[model samples]
Target: MKKLQFLSSLGFFLFGFLLFSNLKAQNSTSSSLYFPPLGEETWEKMPVNQTGWNQGKLGEFLAWMENTNTRALLILKDGKIVVEEYRGNRLTGLGPMNEGSIWYWASAGKTLTATLMGMAEEEKLLKRKDRTEKYLGKGWTSMSPKQEKAIRLIHHLTMTTGLNDQGVDLDDTDPSSLTFLAKPGTRWSYHNASYTLLKNVLESASGQSFETYFKEKIGDPIGMGGFWQRTGKNHVFYSNARSMARFGLLLLAQGQWDGNQIVTSDYIREMTSSSQGLNPSYGFLTWLNGKSSFKLPAIQREFEGPIVPSAPKDMYQAMGRNGQFLMVIPSENLVIVRMGAHSDTSLIPYRLIRDMWDRFAPVIE
Candidate 1:
């Protein structure tokens, strides 16, 4: 009787150990994100069933995007393409919006400038604390020398330069257009003219055209191909959707590509997290999703709650006019990119993203 009891006790212990080990393996596999090889078209895929994603629901969501003028929507889970949809045409002309078609990133390109500024700082080409006048010269603005000097390069990155956005030339890069409204760091206003001046600041500091500096520092190294176009006083970035995805992936990996550290980890934290107090939902030209409150473009009013409630609390995004978006969710190991014609104003894309999350939540853990 004693021998039989010992055999049964050993059997129970073995079963419990195997069950715990299997559960651990599944959690580890599901929770981690993947990184693909640079310069390769190949990427791995996580099967829908394995991901706990409902196939029928995903089909319904794609169908809804088709009716909403969505040109292209790509969602990456663990660095692999899980949902890819392309529709509509290029906005400037009638052409199929495929993987090869390039589209403007509009204001979303601000984050690119922010990244370049960080990289330049990493290389000791410029410092964020330096005054704008240091690069653009003493008389570069209409403000008194003292007031102008108060506006530093970091102010440009944080949207706290206190430059007037009510001027006739919002996109103007001319010194006169950069009129003073409030003292630097006293207010938070999304002034395009103030942001566009970073082009000149970077050029003067680095002694390189924006294109050359970007190509050598980021584009060529990561296999991303995009060009900046002069539109009025603003330089807008244009690239295919995949190129945008590659940039998002770079950020998702904390500015690292494969094993190479493209940008310092400290800069990545500063750029993606909050850079100022006035608008808690903004980083260094990047829009943070989860915060206690947020300010919007062309408006001084502050709203309560995260920018996008449905998105993960840690998500940070680059959004543009006409609905271009590159969203990175670190907690979920997810990167989402959307490029299309304008749909709504007043940043209602927050609602759009909320709906997207509602559909994706059931699929993801």
Candidate 2:
């Protein structure tokens, strides 16, 4: 009977040990985020069943995306591809749009530029408080020396340069094109000329071409494939849908890639959060959702409530003209990328976010 009692206690001890080990493994798996291998086409996919999403609803959501002129759509959950589909043809009529096809990021590339600026700041290459004239030199804008000196890198990033955003080609970077409207920090407008000139700021401070600096600092590091294409005076970024998803993943990780701090966490926080009081929804070249109020691009009037009502309160986005979008929702460990032709002609298609979240919220919830 003593021998029997000893064997029973030993069995209970073994069972408890095994149970504890299993629980620890589960917790580790749940806490860790996946990172895809660099320079390879390999990306892990999380099965729909494993994601706890309604499969039927997801199908409907994808169908809705295709019907709305979507060429490529990628959704990542915890750094794993959950929904990836390439539908329709290229907007340029070059060929069918696929995973490898390149598309213009339009204004969505602004977020990328913003990331580079943050990285530059972290490297002691530039300071946000530095005047724009210091990089572009005096008479870069039509504004007087005093007015021009008042404009800072932060003002350009936040779109509060006080430059005349009306009655001129917003993309024109010529000194004559950039006329002063208000004192710096007094007004907020989506002045593309001011934003585009950041290319010069980046180039001047880093002592490297924008493309070279971008590839060395960001693109190559994160395994992203893209190049800055000159479209008239504007330099737009073009890349495959996967490249866009990779960027969103970097933002989701708060500028970390595979245990490397590519961009400082402090800069990332500032880039994603509200940059100024003028527009609560606008970040540093990024658009934030869930703000109390938001002002649309080129419009002075402010609207009530969050930009995307159906999305998570913590969601922010890199939105572009037409339908290009890179949305990051940290709260859900989710990153979504959509690239395609014009869904609408508005300078920034705010409605697409609303429609996407409306269909997307149901499946995830």
Candidate 3:
């Protein structure tokens, strides 16, 4: 009887030890990612040979970027910089573009706004299902009160507000510029006006100016040196290339920076995953690569297959009007940022992403 009792105790101890070991392993793996210090120019880097990438193809890949008008390109592996390069003129009389030069994110800033919305939701300051009129008040849009009531805050995030997008400048946010089209959530259009109104929604819900809230909640904490600029009627975000990479790293880490959960992981999952069925390739203001079909800006029909065929199925992007791209691939533990002048006239530039991956895959894979 004594022997049996001793054996049982030993068994329990062994089981507990194994469990503890497993948990520790997981924590170590998750914590392996490095984050650059806040308010500093220093960032850790991983050696190219250690990344196991084909070094021979790297030069050609970078040459492709320069030839394609890429001003800045950064690639991070496990939160460590693998490759960082800046080329081309600044065009702002600020000399040649470099690591410290500022560039417009254009529509890529939509992802930043979406993350802010998620943070606000986690704090109970706002809910995705809340009506836009709740924050913007009545008569904010030209639609009738009853019609506008059907449009929820989620509709704006998903770009399904059914606002009229038939014009040269779909980003105009004025009440007169916003006119009713189809019923809310019944159509999927990349209407910028609906997205731009989200700024007001965030402001009204948070009881703080958009700039102040963003800086406090995201920018300062992550060491992002950027600011929102008012260009005509639109509010655009501008930041240096490394600042953009830092945001991508935050996304790659599932909204966590170092040990702090800046934005809840739950909301990050929802924001990156497919939000609506009409366009499976679009998340909440973010573009997804792997989906059955995708819809483009100003286009009525859906295109078959993934938006970027060469990109990993799990990869999602924060793309802008010009060649700006913030791509996050969780499976590969990679975050790539590209900021440049217009590579093409297309709004989302799905083809540009696809072609870039075509040149990049040989080097990385």
lDDT of 3: 0.89
Off by over 4 Å in 1: 1-33, 92-94, 345-349
Best by TM-score: 3
Query: Clash totals for all models, in order?
Result: 0, 0, 0
Colliding residue pairs in candidate 2: none
**TM-scores, each model vs. reference:** 0.87, 0.91, 0.92
Model 2 residue 297 lDDT?
83
* Stretches of candidate 2 exceeding 4 Å from the true structure: 1-31
1-365: candidate 3 lDDT, tens digit per residue: 99999999999999999989965753464487899998789999999999999998887888777777888899999999999998877849568888899999989999999999999998999999999999999998888888888999999999999988886368788888888889988899998888888899999998999999999999999999989988877789999999999999888877889988798766888999999999998999999988999999989899999988877899999998777899999878899999987648677877788889998888877
TM-score-wise, the better of 1 and 3 is 3
The all-Cα superposition gives candidate 3 an RMSD in Å to the true structure of 5.1
Alpha-carbon shift of residue 161 in model 3 (angstroms): 0.5
Worst lDDT 10-window in candidate 3: 22-31
Question: What lDDT is reached at residue 222 by model 1?
Answer: 82
